[model samples]
Target: MKTLSEDLMLLIEREISGQASPEELVTLNNWLSADKKNIKEYQVLQQLYRGHQTLLRNNIVNTDEAWQKVSNKIEILQNSNKKTIIYRWYYVLSAAAAIFIIVFFAWVFRINNQVVTIEAVAGNEQFLLPDSSSVSLKKGSAITYNRSFKKGRSVIVKGIAYFDVKHIVSNSFTVITNNTLIQDIGTSFLVNNTITKDEITVFSGEIKCINLSTKAVINNIIAGKKIINYSKGFVVTDFTDTNILSWKSGVLDFPDVSLTRVLEDISLHYGITVKCLPIDLSNNIYVKLHFENQPIQEVLNEIKLVTKLQLRKGNNEFIFFQSVKNESSQIKKQK
Candidate 1:
C-alpha cells in the first residue's frame, strides 16, 4: 500500500465529511480516477470510520449521549443543505458519521500526544518528572515530554540541563538534543546543546550516545566521562573540569585557572557577558577562588582583590580592565 500525504488524507476527510469545496471535490475526484489504489485507500478509511462508530455504539455505556451528539450534527448538516437536488438519506447519514468519527479520533490522538513543556525562567529550576526522575534546567533552557511520559521515559532538551534519572526495570530513560540521543543506564548527566555542537557529561552510571541522523552508536559514556558531538563526528574525553555542575550546585570554583577562562565560566554561570579591556591583561593573570551561593558583585570583588583588575558592571555584563592609576604607573616605569 502506498503511503498517503497528510494533505491527501485531509482532502479525503473533507470529502467524506461533505465539507469539501467544489474545486476540492474536482481535485479529489481526479485523484480517485487516477488510480484504483486511491479508491482502495479511501474505502479502507471509510471502513475504519464506520467500524469505530459501531464499536463505540455497541460497547460504550453512554451510548445514548454519544449517539445524540452524532445525530445532532447530522441534523444540523441536513438542515443546512439548501440545494434542491435530493439525495439518498443513507448517503447523508454516512457523511455525518464520517465527520464525527474522524473528528472524534483526531481529538483523542491529540490528547494522548499532548506535550508538556517545562522552561527555566531563572537558573537552577529543578523539578521531578512523572517517573520520579529529577531535572535541573539552566536559565532559558526548556524540556518537553509527552503527557504519557511515564509510559515512555523520554524528553527533548533545548539548551542546558542536568538529569538524575530514576531507573525502572524494563524501561529506559532517554534524552534528545540536536540530532543526538542519549539513553541513560540509570545515571545523572549534564547535556549542553549549542548551535554547532552538543556536549554530554556523565556524572554517574553510564549512557549510550547515538547519532540519530546516521543511526550509529557513538559511545557508551561511563561515569566521569564526557562526549562532544559535532556535525561531522564526535569525541569522547575525560571530565577535565570538576565544576561543570557549578550552575546547578551554586558553586563557582576556579582552581588556579587563567583569568580569561575564569571570566568565561563566571559569565556562563551568571548568564551575562564578561569582557576584559586590553584582552592580554586577562591572559597573563591567573587566580584561585571558590564561591558558594554568593552574589555576582561579591564574586567580582574577590576577583578584583586577587587579580587587582578594575571591575565595572553594565546591563547584564561585567568588564575587567586595567585601572587608570595602574596604567599611569606602568607608563612611568616604561619611560
Candidate 2:
C-alpha cells in the first residue's frame, strides 16, 4: 500500500498508547501478522513518539470521540444547502486540529504531524541544534528530535555522532541509542554505535552511560575517557584513545594500538577489508600512525612496512600474513 489510511494510523497510535479497543487490537494484530514490514512500521512510529507523561495525557483526546464531534459538525453543516458552510466547517475543524498539533505533537512525526529527523546521508554533517548545542553526524547516521525541541534537550542517535552540548542551567542533554542512554552534564562526547559494538567517548566532559536493558551504569566516563562494549566483555578505559574522534577531523590517528585494532578501524573508515593472519605474531605488536585523506593503498603500505607482513590481495579483500619466509600456513582471510 502507498500509505496507511488515517483511521489505521489512529488505531496504531491508540494501540501503542494503551487506548486501542479489543476489536481494534485484533484488527491491528491481524494486520501486523500479515507482513513483517508492518511490525517495522509500527516500531518506527513508536520510536518517533515522545514519552512525556504530560504530552501523553494531553494527546489522549479520544480518537472515537473526536471523530464523532467532527461527524456531528458535518451533519449540522449538511442541513444547510450552502456548500460553503461545509467547507468552512472543515476549515475550522482543520484549524483546531492544527492548533492541537502545534501545542501537543507538531511537525516531523506524522502522529497528528510533528517530528523532526536529522540525518547525515553523506559525509559528516554538522547540525546546530535548537538548544544552541552542536552535533556532527557521521555518514549513514541519523537522529530524531522534537520539531519544537520542547520538554528537554535530547536526541536519539543511530550511527556515530560527536556532540558539543551547550549546557543550560538545570537542563541536561541526552543521547539515546538502542542499547544505551548517555546523559551529558555540560560536555563534549562521541557516540559510536556500529554493527558490532557500541561506544561512548568523552573528550571534554562527564557522562553517565547506562545500559538500557539493565539500567546499570555502564560507565561514568569523565573527560578524556572511553567506554566500549563489544564481544560480550566491556572495556572502561580512562585517558585512553583520546584521538578516537580524529576521524571527524579527517584524520585517522592510532598511536600504539594493536594491529588487530588498527585493521578493524581501517576497515571501518576506508570501507576496505583487512584480515590479520592467525599466526602468533605476538598480539603485543602495535602500530602508531596517522593518515589524513590518504589512499587505502598508501595506508596498507604503511602497515606492511611497520609490521613487515606480506599483503595478499584477493578480490576487494586484503589478507596480511607473516613474511613469506615465515609460516605461510597460518594465513587467514577475514570475513
Candidate 1 lDDT by residue in tens digits, 103-203: 56654443433457899985569999999999999889999775556655667788999999998756777776655778788899999998678899999
Candidate 2 lDDT tens digits, 1-335 = 34988988898676555455444544565565456587567656654454333345666445456567667766677667677796878776895686557544432233532347878876779878888898998888898775555345557778989999997756657676665667787799888886566788888867876654444565457887778755353678776554466557768887677778888778877767887776345254576788898889999999888777888897888988786675644323232
The most accurate candidate by lDDT is 1
Q: Report the CA-based lDDT of candidate 2 relative to the real structure.
A: 0.69
What stretches of model 1 exceed 4 Å from their correct place? 1-114, 313-316, 324-335
lDDT for 327 in candidate 2 is 60
Off by over 4 Å in 2: 1-113, 194-197, 217-220, 228-235, 256-258, 282-288, 306-308, 322-335
